[model samples]
Target: MKIVDLGDFTVDTQARRLYRQSEELAAEPKVIEVLCYFIQHADRFVSLQELHQQVWQGRVVTDTAVRRTISKLRTLLGDNDTEQPKYIRSQMKRGYQLVCPALPGEEPAVQSHAAVETNAAKKNKLIQSHWLKQLVAGSVVSALVLVVAFVLLASPVHLHTDYLQVELDIPGQKASLALSPDGHYQAFVGRVNSGDKWQLYLHNRQKGQLAKVSTPVPHVRFVDFVANGAAMAYVGFRQNVAELYIQPVADLAAKPQQYVLPGLSILAGPLALPNNQMLIAGGESYNGNIHYYQLDISTGQYSQFSF
Candidate 1:
């Protein structure tokens, strides 16, 4: 069987199996095929079209599908798109290439008759020694378990009842708090001074750096970070009317997109949805009473839900 040797893994061409230090890795067949193709063309960059033609055998597949396959292969190979890839590297606007060296397969050595007999004798001795080692290892493990149990029983466990307290030095009172999905940054509405209005501010949990996210606004009722942590949505009041705005977290100076719900005063919400949609709860005066409505961000349409 032809076996190509990668630094940390070996690929069996005939069996179509990948092994890491003699341990078999559970990878999909397509992933292995992709890996083999990369290894075959390890010398240069393999374009996306070449991968589709050779690895997929000219099957009708979307670019997204190919990218997903590459992502899965990267995960299996212990690589990532964020970090500097060790095995597979992506060529910008092109395709991917195997960065690591994969040596060609070598033929197995032939054994002489006397050498074969000697190997058989050594194998039997190894089997006997293996049993003895197992017994010793079991005894050692049992003793270790007993010692650990005794130590755990003898040691008095102290309950930790201390709560972590974080203090932020702010010039004014803080309002709503919105933590990022990754728990790295926190966005909150805070007033700079007693007479000033509430504005959006961001706090870095790791660095303890606080910065203003928005300019001085009248009031920020609600704030929420997007799922991707790239942007945030907030409901702010202007001239006694509530409006929804979305701002990028990285560049707070950029103009935010404003979504105005005519005749409806937003009481709460601006919740983010998948694909740039937002859910809002507000009320509009109709007839003689205020009727609650749910507004869709995409179409700017509202439907009456409650009174």
Candidate 2:
């Protein structure tokens, strides 16, 4: 039941685990023991000789070994100021003591509650702003074509039809673009120069703000807004293999879940369908025959479909 809340990190004494912002930190046994020892004896100073007898239990430990454990524990706690001593203070040959100045559980609880309130407020604002927008797309690539691939994709509304073309300030060549179903965001594939690697760029169309979407979307070749603007699915390559990814519109920065294609080698035609499903053209690797499939967005499963 003992937990050490160090403000920057928390320790589960029973599990011997150290965590920072919910991420489990890799620590040696000695590092955990040293951290736990410092926390349990925060009220008084701990001498080096005491640590050798108590924590190490006379295990033939050297001075360097003990110092290394202390150093590693400090790193895990993000304690950079050794002189001022934010978490643990080491006096020259005078041993060490925990100096974080918080009761074991008080600080982390306060921080977690504040974080929940801030996140709830932000989420409410986001949902309200997004609900006010809307995007119209009857075909899979119709809306996407109007954004990034406009110069190449053929529009059905007559070849010579004139429309106002407004260029965006984004650098380099843009490959693919998808407007959220509610027109709140734009997800596109772009690059810095001709040879630069392509990456997914998520733009808040309403706010005019831009950010780079992380991995799985890197080298992204195609993107489509799905689930009525709540999420998006895209085709990206990993290990030279074509993989599908699904990411939520609310959490675009989150790592997208990847889906592998079992039989189909060549994938094409991600036409939007009803019930959050999509139709894709799959071709056999050996034979040139193409097959049609229905992809379930919720499960990332693909099944054959007949015309």
Model 2, position 209, has a per-residue lDDT of 87
Q: Candidate 1, residues 120-186: lDDT per residue as tens digits?
A: 6864575467457659978999998997677667873742325336557766788778777688889
CA lDDT of each candidate? Answer: 0.69, 0.69
State TM-scores per candidate.
0.41, 0.44
Give the root-mean-square deviation of each candidate in angstroms.
21.8, 16.4
Cα lDDT of model 2 by residue, 143-259, tens digit: 666654564465645555466554358768986677776778888888989887778778887788888878643467777777777777777765445667778878866778765
Which candidate leads the pack in lDDT?
A: 1
